[model samples]
Target: MAEIRLENVVKRFGTVTAVDHGTLTIEDQEFVVLVGPSGCGKSTILRLIAGLEEMTEGYIYIGDQIVNYVEPKDRDIAMVFQNYALYPHMNVYMNMAFGLKLRRFSAEEMDRRVHEAAAILGIDELLDRKPRQLSGGQSQRVAMGRAIVRKPKAFLFDEPLSNLDAKLRVSMRGEIRNLHDRLKTTTVYVTHDQVEAMTLADRVVVINQGVIQQVGAPLEVYDHPINTFVAGFIGSPAMNFIDCRVVQDGPNILLDGESFQFPLSATKDGMQIFSHLLGKEVILGLRPEDIEDREFVKDQKEGIIKATVNMVEPMGANVHLRVASGMHHIIACVSPKTRAKAGENIDLVCDLSKVHLFDKETEKVISKSPITG
Candidate 1:
């Protein structure tokens, strides 16, 4: 496996830039995922690395060699696409062996590599089945097997599970993770699905408007996002953001609003950051899970914000409640066992340590704390 690096990478299409002054180092044998919303250039980064799209500026390196001028074939990377791109007439074994045949490997070597890859992917039993005859999951396994047979320096996946049904997508996600673990290839995956990025990546690069917002472990980014964009993008149902004025609470800081006012705990470094925002409007970010149901909260915990329940969504194990605190609306997760109705006044306790404070104007996270508030 090779280490991949992009230094001051820039990709431009006419007057518009698809990737803007991006720099990142993907470690050897690391599973890195590029994630963002639609039109965020996640796919563009993948294409650049694959040599499918030339960069307008900067350098791309694979291991110690600069690959800016290298042809895609010589780069020695395998790419799996969202469409699976299988030849309908060919069976699984033939499809996997095609790349080796083009490279002119001996028939014995080709067969050995193809069979090995198929076995690793647990698709050896369906080697004789044509692409049209195979299920979506089977087709995906074949695409992966084809890439594995070549044993490239890196693997690039461009939303490979996107075409599958929800259940199949979940199953394929596990398969991809297992493949990365067993092979330990330097893999770069691109997806707009935050769930896929969170579940499958060793590290996730959150990008927006062709620029990287934050890059870190999935849970790390989810827990302590560097900006409002990341905190809003990384988690399901997204983080709850409410505007408030900062107020002094003894030596610490408190967020005061129309319906609620709670002291920000001194334990969180955010207190110091909020010092500058005292008496000024600041954005308060709290994840749905961070806001606990009043009944389940511990009194010793600091910062309790009260709100009126506005809506409820029961999601099997847990219930999601959208509550309004004065003019601001926030979502909190409640236990399914506890019955909650709309219009009910609910006490939503905010974990001060888990709170995220953002600059009202800059929108960047000022607090150094690494977990979701």
Candidate 2:
């Protein structure tokens, strides 16, 4: 295991910049995920680290050595691609042992390593099966087993589970996490799926338009996003953004949306925190989970918004409501017992204490209410 570091990394293709001055460190045995939408340069960064792509400007370090000019084979890292990349003619055992064979390992040593890796992955019985005969999940395990037997300094996965079905993806996610726990190998995973990043990463590096947005623990990013982009991109249902102006209602400060108004602060300190934005427009952000159906809310005195339900999706444990409040469309995750239905007016209680305020011009978070739940 080794720590990997990138210093001022920049990758450009002709006139387009793929990665812009990215500097980060992956601690030894830590699992870091590079998560972003397609064409966000996450895979480019991985390839750069693996010595597969030349950095336009920067230095990469594996342990204490600078490897900018190192050949990929000398980088001591194993990469698992989106496609399994298994040898079609070779069975699972040979495919996993091929790397060792090329390295000229003794037959007995290669045999022991291959079988051990297969057993760890629970695929010992599938050793003789060809890639064509294996299911997607099984093929993925073989790919992982191939990487494990090499015991490289770091493992890079480029969306290894994308080919699997949803249920298999979830199951494989657990298996991957378990594999990491047992091996404790340094890992860098690239994926566009936020759920995968949230569940798999020790630290998630969120990227957008080839730029790093925010790097934090999943809950940290979810609870306290650096900006609107990070706030909207990290959540499942996504946060609702409403345009509102800060106004003073006698002694209380309130956010005045065209359709609704909510108190910014009832306490002196809360008022002081938001006093600067007295008459300026700001964006109010509320997560779906933070908005509750009025019928289920115990305290209905604050942050009430009346909306016409446009659609209702009944998830097993919760219901997703798509409602319109004047011009703003909002999604709220309420309890499954909610009586809300399409075409009916419903009241929603937005948890004021969990609200996020962003500067309208910069779209950067100016203030975040303390988390109550």
- TM agreement with the true structure for every prediction: 0.95, 0.97
Model 1, span 1-373: residue lDDT tens: 4999999999999877889999999999999999998988888888999899999999999999999999999999999999989988888899999999999999999999998998899998999999999999999999999999999999999999999999999998998999899999999999999999999999999999999999999999998898999989999888988887887877766677768876654545656545667788878888888777878765744567778888988999799998888898888887786567898987777666677878889898867442223
Worst 10 residues of 2 by lDDT: 364-373
Q: Which runs in model 2 stand beyond 4 Å of their true positions?
A: 370-373
Top of the candidates by TM-score: 2
Where model 1 places Cα greater than 4 Å from the true spot, the runs are: 249-252, 265-274, 298-301, 368-373
Per-residue lDDT, model 1, residue 286, is: 84
Alpha-carbon lDDT of model 2: 0.93
Question: Per-residue CA lDDT of candidate 2, range 85-112, in tens?
Answer: 8999999999999999998989999999
Clash pairs, model 2 backbone? none
